[model samples]
Target: MSGSQALKADALDFAGDTATYALSLFVIGASLRTRALASLIKGASLAAIAIAVLGMTVLRVMNGAPPEAATMGVVGFLALSANVASVLILLRWRDGDSNVRSVWLCSRNDAIGNVGVIVAGGVVALTGTAWPDLLVAALLAGLFLKSASAITLQALRELNTTGASHATPVESSS
Candidate 1:
């Protein structure tokens, strides 16, 4: 991937995460069903991001060019630091319901992806090629997809449980 393309993809990632986190905040105080719905939305958003990154990476591979290694390394480090802070903040709530878990997953995945990008930057710097960037992008896309799948599944289960509980008849005593 080219330097500019990587930067653009990273920016989109940040924007998507920010929007999803904001959505979570809005639904935090709602019912379990609502929070599960928020998680569903977040999962869909993450899947979309994964698809978008995959597409971009494939195109970058087809038309290969070297990324700016120094820039990539610096930006990746900055993103990594931000993700670390987010992960730490969300860690306490990692075991929460689907909505909170989605937030934690997003932050955790981004932190891992940032490390991949930093490694890619170092590889590109040493090799003077774009393959490392492409590989990192592809791997990050995979990570996003995996996280999305998990969040989606958990949300569906929670929703199903909520629905099942509602469907059960309550017993009464005389």
Candidate 2:
């Protein structure tokens, strides 16, 4: 309810992260190929979100008011704090296969995105314009797209190397 497009974008990123974790759970007992496929799906989903956020940013730029700066600042700081904690916790496992690495990337993204949100909030507070908010949102979308591309490329590489032996492996432990 802050009217901040930046915060809205961050919220979407958090939602995407949650979904990624859910997908991770589904592949916990699966093999490399299955995990890679899950990562690919997650990456594709993130790409879709980025495109949608960009479209939203464009519309907001055309006709949007400044958000509540105070609210944005407070929430952004809180988000950043939480994300940083997650980042620290996930740092050790950041370098792994596509699926495992995607987890760390998504967690890292929240902290980086929050910094932008906080900066946008301060700029909006000073200028009383939504331009900063919209800009940050768009930039976050670009970040999302970049992360998605990384995940997708790594996943494709893993799939290629693993061959077509288990393209559609069942995830059941038994």
Candidate with maximal lDDT: 2
Q: For candidate 1, list the clashing residue pairs, or say none.
A: none
- Segments of candidate 2 deviating more than 4 angstroms: 164-174
Candidates in order, TM-scores: namely: 0.92, 0.92
lDDT of each: 0.85, 0.92
Q: How do the residues 1-174 of candidate 2 rate in per-residue lDDT, one tens digit apiece?
A: 999888999999899899999998889679888999999999998999899899888888878889999999999999999999999998998988888899999999899999999999999999999999999999999999999999999999999978866578769987
lDDT tens per residue, model 1, 111-172: 88778878888998899888888888887788889989999999999999999989968789
For every candidate structure, what is the RMSD over all alpha carbons to the true structure, in angstroms? 2.8, 6.2
lDDT of 1: 0.85
Per-residue error for 77 in candidate 2, Å, reads 1.0
Clashes of each: 0, 0
User: What's model 1's TM-score?
Assistant: 0.92
- Give me candidate 2's TM-score against the actual structure: 0.92
User: What's the C-alpha lDDT at position 170 in model 1?
Assistant: 75
